[model samples]
Target: MAGPDLTLDQARQQANLAFTASGTEFAFGDAAALPLPIAQMKALSAGSPGVETLHDGGLTAEVLCLKHAGRRWAVKRARPVCRVRNIEGQTSFLNELQRHAELAGLRLPGVIRPVYGSLRDGLVVSPWISGRHPGVLDERQARTLLETGCALIEHGFFEWDYSAGNLLDDGERIWLYDFGYCYRFDPLTQFNSAGHGCEHPRHHLAERIEGRHLFGALLDAGNDDEALPHFIRFKRLAAQAYVDLADRLARRGATPPVLGHYRGLAARWHQELAHAPGLLYLASAWQAHSSDLDDDLRGRSCTPRTLQRAQWLQATLGAQGHRLRRSGALSPDDAALDDTALLRRYHDREVEARRCQL
Candidate 1:
């Protein structure tokens, strides 16, 4: 195996690159290799013929698709100003530039690497992946995404946002192209890149997929009968993936707590999948939806799906607050609220979510 593209030391040094008044130039390999010259790439505009503008609800950059040398390429330009008001939003472009280099080096499958990028020029170029954002996930698509995500975790890259826009399916395989929100963490010791790394165990790989994408797809299901089968399939896959992840991390000398974490989850999921899968689904659904809603609210980038998620929470709280509480799905504060109080709280959140639409 060639191993990953950059060593930890090299990745750290690259991350510290500073932008001067003249702007820092960055590239994965040969910037001269692009079909278009750097000057022409920097001057690309949406109005130009043969350019197809893509507004994928991205907050930090504008994406344009065009043909070059008989092939399609996606040219992403950083927005003059990012839409989200947070610090992470402000610096995401530079962060992505850094990730682009590291991921290019790793050369992981299904992860599209940029041919060239320049932070100073606020540009990145990659072959345009030929796929659409799946409105719903079949078993094959779900397993493909899960396998790809697991591979990333094993390599210490934690991808936070697996939203619909960040994914594509070119008939045969799913592709992950964006790296703006992907960050490095110690796979042997930490659960994720969130607060103090291991402090947030709820932000694991399955939670992210379930919260950001799967549950959203389930929201359109007519009833539990329709959604239950899909959730079951995913949970089965996740349990096995956790088992494999735990084994790999253990061989790498992961700490006891980290190993125990994955093993415990696998055990519990297996137990639940055999006996009380409904409770498992309910608990995971509550956590995933609530967490994702909070993320959007904090980032001030809520969308129509955000509103729907808020509504789902409110409705679920009304109909199954008791079940959620019994299933240990509710947090301490949420567990304390009565049904009416919980309903009212989520209703307020729904209104706020609508106000924050990007």
Candidate 2:
């Protein structure tokens, strides 16, 4: 007789088999009893009543609904490809969930409450907060939301993937979701302020804001001229917040990867400021292309050549627009002066100059 077709149990068994073959442990659980409390789920769902597909972005499966217990939540399941063929991809996802759990209570989205399976066949659940996109908010509202989101990250010592889609606004409040890639920073590299990697990822930001109708609406609201300046200032403040938190982490002797990551980040911010000065004010020109900063800043793969070009652009733009100042104090000839200080200074000078000009 041929082998029996796999039922849910059989499928789960297969999943376990696959995980074991891949040198990982696979433990099964009662699906009905999730790690998170049913009460917490009900409170989060606010009586939404049933599971509904919120997003099917192809990479992951997402279901939004109120559990039978009356709590709102989001359940995320990796695609079969991730489970079977791309185990490493699943490992990243699992790592993300673990990080989220560790970083809970930082006013960030809740943790990935593991449910019903080992790492290979698990479901991750988090609270569902209803909100609109930042691009949809009015100028004042958008700025406030962005500031709040950044502030949350600052306090949490967590770096969020700031792509537009991960941010949501629900009329009165803005919410950030999708914490699978979040990580803690080392205080030393993070606090140095002159280290690298402080710059926001432009490509991710661009992807978030592009094609959002609300972005166009914001641009058309007679405030297109101010958006770029607002965003630049926002980014600077956010970077500083990260630096401060990272410094704290460093003092505690955080992990090497975490320290290195923030160091790289601080450096990036400095480099961007020294090089791509035009990008600082690009948001103001949004109306001309009907594209918001988030959309326009995507996929900015930088290299030595691109860095040189950005620096040239900065010099060229500095002749017309205001200049950015270096932030923290440094020796006049410190070769160790990484790009971070220069960028912070540049941001400070530019913002101050713009304020005066306005």
Candidate 3:
């Protein structure tokens, strides 16, 4: 009566099949009617008068702002050799192009659409988005990001990286312009595009946002009093969003664990929001910082935040490790480590982070 459930890798292959078959190059709409002439757009050098090099953008690509015919467009040229030196980094541009096609077809909100791209040419062109990466998010920005993330999940796209560079805020809504790390999975039966999909149940939309953005933003808050309020607000929003997400998935015939995962998170967050919000904040912050720190280390693309996260982990283990243990914040492997060992590990990581600074 129905097709068999697919593994995460299978799902990804199916999703990108057409793109692969079509030689992995794509251009949306009539190229003849494109906003900028593709030849001229590609030919323009970084030092050209009207071309502005935004930043190195690190590892995968370089972006330039092109002022053509009075309109600004962002021209992203993939590096001949990706700096991150991993399979994911090497293939990120093609993955992004695939996601752009999928998202454009879905007409998903809060995502900036690219006008043209070619994998072979190592180029992607989209209208320049006028926005800033805000260190701290207000309610509107936070809610918008949550909604966009939920939409991606509900539609089977798992966005792994929500780093500051991937998001932009135009004073009203947050825009997701980077899909380099986003992948597809069977949302009806899988948690994410990792470890056979459902094996890593702890990874989810809220977890990603916290690990990649929220906790980093909270790092700026001078004290618990300043940060607690923001965490509380985010927890409240995320809990409700999960509940709503669970309901939508249930209607789509999602599996029990998938349903329970969101429901459990919502219930726990709600309970904590009422009684032990501080514990919730502490446990989540510890987990977030630690997870992101590991990601940076594994990628060998550490940033200043990686050092900060490592220091936070060291300080937390030294000061509140017992509480972390009680709160079940430590991973099973981490739980085995004594406070001294944990502190030493993080201290070493901090040094490694300094060496790998991007």
Candidate 4:
């Protein structure tokens, strides 16, 4: 395996980016988006932030439901220490502050509007909308997700995390809240902030959804079978989103090569959607399964999906491993395992991963 994308010294510097306690005032981005003044927000966060409506996972910070004036808001106070422990986790809060600072005043439908944020005070306050975390992503939700995701990429921000916990639908629109994992990248040239950029262009917006949100839902046999239709729906939406995205990028004066790069994946997916939906499904499944499993193995944050992916790989190898292998779907490690050894390996890993799950 190659070394980490960053040098050891760079990693150390990144890992040290913890939140500091200072009296630095929360910079209010949109006072109009807030129900209360900056003083009220400061007071609410001066101590343990109140929990009017609780949130599940912050990983990098403590999230609370803030009650101010006659409204509720989300106050994400940076924990003195982050739960994620990695360089991304260590710097996530600071990264969020930076992203929010850029997106503060933008009137984007899919992005959460921040009322206030700060580096020293270690928190951000945004209006609390009564929203639902989607289960089976409906057509509107799927379309909105790709639309917004493309928008972020076009604007030079690469949002890395798209897990269910980070998204909310207020019935009218979908909103992206967490920016701790979102980083700045060249929209016109880079594939993502992960160093793939245009060099490895396959990792686009739809792939992010599959890894972070969709595939986890397809945890078992029944859901896995159902995933085909869900994926098709997303692909359809994404095709249209790409069309709009390419036009917008061109208008923004993106270079022709960059514009061509943006349009290439979309055009291919569109053609496949028209002529060979099944091929697209197989390709997508292979990519999603391979990518997500590697993510778990690397992070070692295995959930049921880790087990499911392993099982799926074993099944695919038995049935059509040759075909998948020819198509570059099977990883070198996966290709090396015999049936008995693979099952045995997955079972052991599954047992270990289960302990980490709940």
lDDT of 1 by residue, 69-170 (tens): 688889899988888666566668877887888888887767888888887788889999888886557878877887889889888899988878888999
Candidate 4 C-alpha lDDT tens digits along 1-358: 2356764324433543422233334354655565656566555533444557545455667677877666777877777788787766766777787788888666666898777787666768877868898766889888888878988888777877788888899997778988877877777656666544555566677788877777666553254456777778888887778778889878878777677766787898889888877667766777777677767777778777677876776576566655665655555796687766755765676566666663
Backbone clash count, each prediction separately? 2, 45, 0, 1
Ranking by lDDT: 3, 1, 4, 2
lDDT of 1: 0.82
TM-score of each: 0.91, 0.46, 0.92, 0.82
* Residue 295 alpha-carbon offset, candidate 3, angstroms: 1.1
lDDT of 3 by residue, 212-261 (tens): 99899888876666998998998899999999999999999999999999
Cα-based lDDT at residue 314, candidate 3: 83
Best by lDDT: 3
Worst 10 residues of 2 by lDDT: 286-295
Candidate 4, backbone clash total? 1
lDDT of 2 by residue, 1-358 (tens): 1144533223433553465568774343344666355444333332344655456552443445444456555666555455223332445455455455554434443222333333545455555565555653545555544455434434433433444566666665556556544444323333211113234322222223332333343344445345545544544543554465457666776656655555565566556656763454342232222222212233222223223223323343344332222322122442254455544544444333333321
Better of 2 and 4 by lDDT: 4
Where model 1 places Cα greater than 4 Å from the true spot, the runs are: 1-23
Stretches of model 3 off by over 4 angstroms after superposition = 1-27
